[model samples]
Target chain A: MNNETEIRKWLEDVMDPEIPVLSLVDLGVVGDIELKEGSVFVEIRPTFVGCPATTQMKYDIESLLHAKGFDDVHVDISYKSPWNSDMITDKGREALRKFGFAPPPKGNLIDDIDVLEHVECPQCGGTNTELQNPFGPTLCRSIHYCHDCKEAFQQFKPMN
Target chain B: MNKTALKELLFKIADDQLILGHRNSEWTGLGPILEEDIAFSSMAQDKIGHSYAMYQILEELGEGDPDQVAFFRKAEEFHNSQLVELPIGEYSFSLIRHFLYDHSDFLRFDMLRNSSYELLAQVSSKIRSELKYHTMHARTWVKKLGTATDDSISRLQNDLDALMPYALGLFEKSPYEEEIISENIFGGEEELRSRWLELIAPIISKTELVLPDPEGVEPVMGGRIGKHTEYLQPLIDEMTEVMRIDPDAEW
Candidate 1:
């Protein structure tokens, strides 16, 4: 298979350990995958600087590619353009919703609005929620308390 | 405090962070689970960031460039205690190491927040906020592992027995320790050490684990004076390889 095709297939099996439903490529954290000469290069942007999954993600990628006969694999971390919920592909969002996380509201496009207008609860489908903390499970997400469900859930926010 | 003393103090703080950060980064791809993978990596990054910040302060004080001060320093010049440089043996060992260090770090930063040096105090304040999460994360894992299956509890206990003595090394006094205290650069080291033990005792007790006696345990010093474990050289080589390749090149 060609490099692009090979990378796309490799990434399909690379699932997010936390959410399980989304792959790194689907999450848009996998910025670019290229074949230079005989080597494979993967570029990723971390959800946040200190996100612990980053280390594991690098290791998993290397092993997976190695298993596929790619001896030279380079992983580059880019922090120039910070990550945001908007980067989540439509397919990823769908997968997340099916996996029980209330995906970003269907009508609220990330680019159309400057700030998150209303974050719908992942549980109980309620719009009535308040931010519980700026930090959630990780720095990339914010904890929001759903008044309807009375449960705290993480909402992926745009990093500024 | 004299300039020499201030520089030593900076080295102590920076060396602790550098070594600890290196240890944490080793867990990047090997975490037991993904959620935890993210958590541990973040802590490592915060530590490295803190180290860089400390190095920057030293640079301004005419020590050297941040990278030079961090990467080129001799092993004997480093002031970090032995606690941070220890290997991250098993998962339990790693957890115990973090548990002891994170709590002590939190208290240290809190005290440093009131330092006579305004810049130092401000930096401490910023680092303290991030350290709160680090402490929470470490505490959660300690509780989870401690209360889990019997095997897990035993593993944690064994790890604690092996590493607690090293944790005491964090309080080993440097020549500048008294100078900083007298000048109010920061609070007294003995008082801080006592407070650290007091804060950690209940946490350790809650885990049903006995605090290992640290009496007469000679600290494995020289990290703060730049004598690092064999692990550090290889780590620094890889971490700075790219930067070193083109020192004059801008990214």
Candidate 2:
């Protein structure tokens, strides 16, 4: 008896395996939900086409929906509209900062090299930070050091 | 489209991505700076994942599974360009190789985005966007290092000279280039190389580094037909060391 809205609420519980602090909903990968006849069709997009977590994410979505009694669940991957870091929700930003990652910038940069140049420390709210590397443990992150806090932090780079 | 030709094209691209991704990953903790470490590692993940997806496409075309095709393949069966398989040397060497490789790769994906093959077109479109950032990253560094100081300029120039021959090997043609072009799967590697030249020349012009005369250097070929440098087999062994230990155990 649960509708698309109800299913969406359930989806918010599906955390990204990589970024454990944020749910797929908050990450903005959960695209559209349609309840057609007895089948529920869910569309999701991966943040990166080569993201290894994508298959796991689709499986998690299916399992969560099936556990909630949606028997005929179909998950489709969408690539028509690209995923950008700006798609990350405000709640996701808070979760990222709480989880020790500097959230992606809200505004899209014309020049992406500027990404590491202006990162503020999530730990001490300090502007005195230097980019340690544009590469990180993960594809979407960069590393930086805060001079004031003396803490090294990972930043979610702004995806184009 | 000829299925064989399409598969041939896809394999080369996938193999290149896989090998380079592994090589780029070797920089994870060894970069001169932490930022560069993270940068190279990020690109490594992207490249490796790209290979995984391409392998999946091959699976759909009736090839083996992605894991088998990637991790289990012998070095001689790999179709990657020789340029990508060379070890990541000094920072200048790596950077120069990165600059040359990414320019051609970005352009290649851009061309494939409009491919007649629907799945390939879709994949290429997504990949092309990601590669845009990669090329931008390469260009920024090449410009910065190419013009920075006498020492920096000379180092980059030396690496650039050393790498150009192998870099030209990126365009080593497929036997089915005619079929590929006829079917519109790709615009052919020769076209991509010409375009890459036009694209890279301007970037080099801004820097102090001199562009090598294409006529002066003979291109290193045969990676497409499986003649790789001696370095590839060892690299592959190292990459698959863990997987080969227990082939069937699930993580």
Candidate 3:
């Protein structure tokens, strides 16, 4: 029987498949974990509803726990409290920037999409970026161009 | 609660997303530019994902499997608005349709965020945020092309004029409208239409494109109760082709 701290620590090794630099815990979508009657019950909250990574993330969690001797594991996808960009850890934010994608701004989410313009560039740390498209190659990312670095980059866009 | 009414409401919304998702995917490689290609393709995935979510709810209410329900149904068995079932005409037409469609969708989901049906409310809250990107994408392109040049402006305006009547069909009253509204499962399509107009008015007014007087526009309705365009069956056929060939095949 492992404690919550030890279980979460073990989850740190389970990285986001798309953004390998960030872990599931760091990405802030491991909704909850409950140890009941010698079984592990995990709540996996998907960052984006359409994100296919959720399916993979669930598999990874289940396999990891199963390998850890939790035979009666229950991993339920919970949208109960939904994922917001603000959930990303401070450590995760730095990891995102280091990985060349701007971490979503903390608590700057608005319903207006134009507010997405001029996200600080992860390349040169410049605020002179322009939004190329609010959509990127993936559902959770948005495209932007940095004026200072003259580079097209992706940002893990903020969601409220 | 009127379970029948709730299911009807869910089916129409889900079917709209599914059909429009197929239409959006039609632009995958054929978009005017690489970015536009990716944009449409991304949106197509989101829309289809939404329909899948809705169908999952329907299944909980005792409907058939989501895959079979989506692939096996004839066009007339679907309740999506005719606006969504139409062919992707020219880029201008598609853009206008996208703009008109997503705005209504955004508003619809936004309203559902507070639905008395807790499951629907939870799903709607998640969906509302994603749809913001869609509306924003539509607005950016409409503004850019609507004001770009005479040709762009007139092409968009013509499409805008042509699409409005069908867009109005989006609000065709449900037979279960009273039940849905009474149960607070939804805010009703008429209310959604009015809110949609308010949401889109300033955006459209900013462009050279004129909003057709919806008052004079005879809405091309009946899709809500399963009537569809000739285009819908063909689109459904294409969508289900692979699935039909191998219903039990692994992806």
Best by TM-score: 3
State each model's CA lDDT, in order: 0.73, 0.88, 0.90
DockQ of each: 0.05, 0.51, 0.71
**A42-96 in candidate 1: lDDT tens per residue?**
8876655446678788888888989888899998765334355567889988887
- What is the lDDT for B116 in model 1? 84
lDDT of 2 by residue, A1-160 (tens): 8788988899999999999989999998998899999799999878887787898999999999888887899998876566777889999999999999999887767256666675888999897898776656766777788999999998987775
True-vs-predicted CA distance for residue B186, candidate 1, Å? 1.4
True contacts kept of each: 0.06, 0.63, 0.52
> Which 10-residue window of candidate 1 chain A scores lowest in summed lDDT?
A108-117
Clashing pairs in 2: A132-B34, A132-B35, A133-B34, A133-B35, A134-B35, A134-B39, A135-B38, A135-B39, A136-B38
Error of 1 at B4 (Å): 1.7
Query: How high is each candidate's interface RMSD, in Å?
Result: 8.8, 2.4, 1.1
TM-score of 1: 0.65
Q: For residues B86-187, could you state the per-residue lDDT of candidate 3 as single tens digits?
A: 999999998999999999999999999989988889889888988888988999999999999999999999999899999999999999899889889899
lDDT per residue as tens, model 1, B1-251: 46777777778888889878888878888978755666667677778877877887788788888877787655556677777777778878888999999998889888988888777786676566557667766776788778788898898889887777667767766677778888888786687778988987877778756777656555555555556667666666766778788887864
Model 3 C-alpha lDDT per residue in residues A1-160, reported as the tens digit of each score: 5987788889999999999999999999897888888888888878887788888998999899999988988888877888888989999999999999998887756576656888999988898989898778899999999999899999998888
What value does the lDDT take at residue A60 in candidate 2?
A: 96
What is the TM-score of each predicted model, taking all chains together? 0.65, 0.88, 0.98
